[model samples]
Target: MSGTLVVGASHAGIQLATALREIGDREPVTVVGAESLAPYQRPPLSKAFLHGSADTASLAFRTPAFYAEREITVLTGERVVDVSPTGATTDRGRHLAFDRLALTVGARVRMLRVPGAGLAGVHHLRDVADATRLRRALTGATSVVVIGGGFIGLEVAAAARALGRPVTVVEAADRLIPRAVAPVVSEFYRQAHERRGTAVRLGAAVTAVTGERGRATGVLLADGGHLPADVVVVGIGIVPRTELAEQLGLSCDRGIVVDRCARTSAPGVVAAGDCTVVGADRLRFESVQHATAQARAGAAALLGREEPVTEVPWFWSDQHDLKLQIAGLSAGHDDIVVRGNPDSERFSVLYYRDGALLAIDAVNATADYLTVRKALATGATIPAEHARRADRRLKEMLVASLDA
Candidate 1:
């Protein structure tokens, strides 16, 4: 009965179990998760779910019948507290023995530890419960203060603004998504949010959350200023759930270290998703694309099959009506080439390093995004000036290069 066991039941873990079954190598597949609900889509929790545009049923990755039909056992409402050479121990004093294990215990939202942080009306959107609570709070909220200009904060601010609530975003960095995109792209997003009546506050640090009667009232800035807030959301970032991996003395540097094959240092044990730092570069990706791909590789490794090659990392965000899609890692990129006018609300920022394409940030430019996404995935490049041409289509140009 004991065979392949995956922890977390997240996008990565679910994909691993599915992949194993797809490959017809299923001995016995089981997924254990801390959440009572099955594995569900996470990105929508910040946008569609928070905005009341989506229901709980829409968030499900797969139905209960799918798991049953696949013969995959799902253990919900169970927390795997410890991992060892052979298996894991749950919080209920249940020790589950496994022949092979996959550790996909994703990350937790990193909370603000300042005063009044524990007050009511302050929320962090990480899962279904978090979004549900935040959505409920928005029903009575008049103003929202979003701490951190990251994707989650911005999306929540947009949702609040759509509901007629005034919103303000406080960012400690000089620009939005500072570590993920270029300054030009950041400025574009700032203008987009501001155009929608969202106050964009940059380079501002929050000293504390001021509360009234055990409920958050406003965020106190370090510069002696206060921003009124009936609802406060802290989206600073996340800390990888590496406790289980660390318990077994697996290599961990902020996250569990895994190779390209998704294999951990420990034998017969591997990791994927936000919980793992993979490849030689030790890149830790949080997007669904990275999670599923790595999980597939892990499943293949578990079955002694050739693993699929990893694709270029890609991520997308839907803020307001703009669809911002990014392909590849933009870190250390030297030059950026703009392909279309940002003033028109449609363009793509091509990231280059010594004339080689590294990444692209496209907003309202899905066609251009598809082209560049494929080019980046295949290690193809285009000349800076040629990419900037208004007469030539980006896909036409990139496809020609691929043909050559």
Candidate 2:
């Protein structure tokens, strides 16, 4: 059947619905979004929008009229609580029967289970409302203590520092963004934030949040030390919303397991976004790019319009004036080549495994960023030594074939 049902109306879900329609699937397209608001870009929720640099209208992925015009039915403010083998059930009591089901339910903010974590000033950044509340909290906060030294926390710290607020970051890891970046990249971030006067407490596990009158005032470290603050933002990570997928008995491990075509274990069921593990490479990403790509690909799978999914995984982060772009996945890269001058704040790091170019991490280098992205997309065979030097133009080297 050409009819498609996509759940979780984030970027992935919305993208699937649109793609299904675009690909000549004429049947009804139902998109279930947990958030009442339309699908929006989440990366800005921690940076530009929190800093009053962007409006809610600007973050919208699609207009309400666009969905209506496309004949796409979007069930907003409805949570698909259960997904049986045959269909999905919503919170407001609606049974959705589907010919093909797509799970694009992204992820949710993971809260720390520490003492006094439920304090009034303790905020978590994930959705638009959370960012809005945090922005309001910033007005009266003289000091801000952020837990988790990930991108969101650091971005929030930057915004608070810009407002002349004393900011402190408490991370259990020895380095910031330990899970995401290499040691050198983490060091670069440490130097950058420290230069901006952000107090970083590395290897500090927050045991409790000290509060007065149900409001967070400070955080007690595992060593019984306290870092005083008027506001707290938690950005540890996210957990995939897999309950519905699990209940439906779809093969789920970490995320709903799907093929390169985005089909779940069960027939007539597909999965996408952060909620599904798609690809022969066993990869799952919560980023906007992955979500959108997976959704479109899943739509194709549902319509039986098989096109080889050749999209490279990509992610980006906006920190201060630096725009970091990563092309391809670097899960098991053994060799990393530092390209461009780090001193110039415009560089690209090439990650390779067994001589195959795996990923490129670009920081403010627009030209090299495009070059490496193209190289990875085209499966170019480039040698490791040549990728490391700033003077060696990768484009020229590629033209000569990577053997040189």
**lDDT of each structure?**
0.89, 0.83
Whole-model lDDT, model 2: 0.83
Best by lDDT: 1
Number of the top-ranking candidate, with TM-score as the measure: 1
Query: Which pairs clash (backbone N, Cα, C closer than 3 Å) in model 2?
Result: 9-33
lDDT of candidate 1?
Answer: 0.89
Give per-residue CA lDDT, model 1, range 139-159, as digits (tens).
889889999998988899889
Score every model by TM-score.
Answer: 0.97, 0.95
Residues forming the 10-long window of minimal summed lDDT in candidate 1: 395-404
* Count of clashing pairs, candidate 1: 0
Per-residue lDDT of candidate 2, residues 114-188 (tens digit): 999999999998888898999999978989999999988899998888777899988899999887777777777
Weakest lDDT window of 10 consecutive positions for candidate 2: 395-404
lDDT of model 1 at position 379 = 64
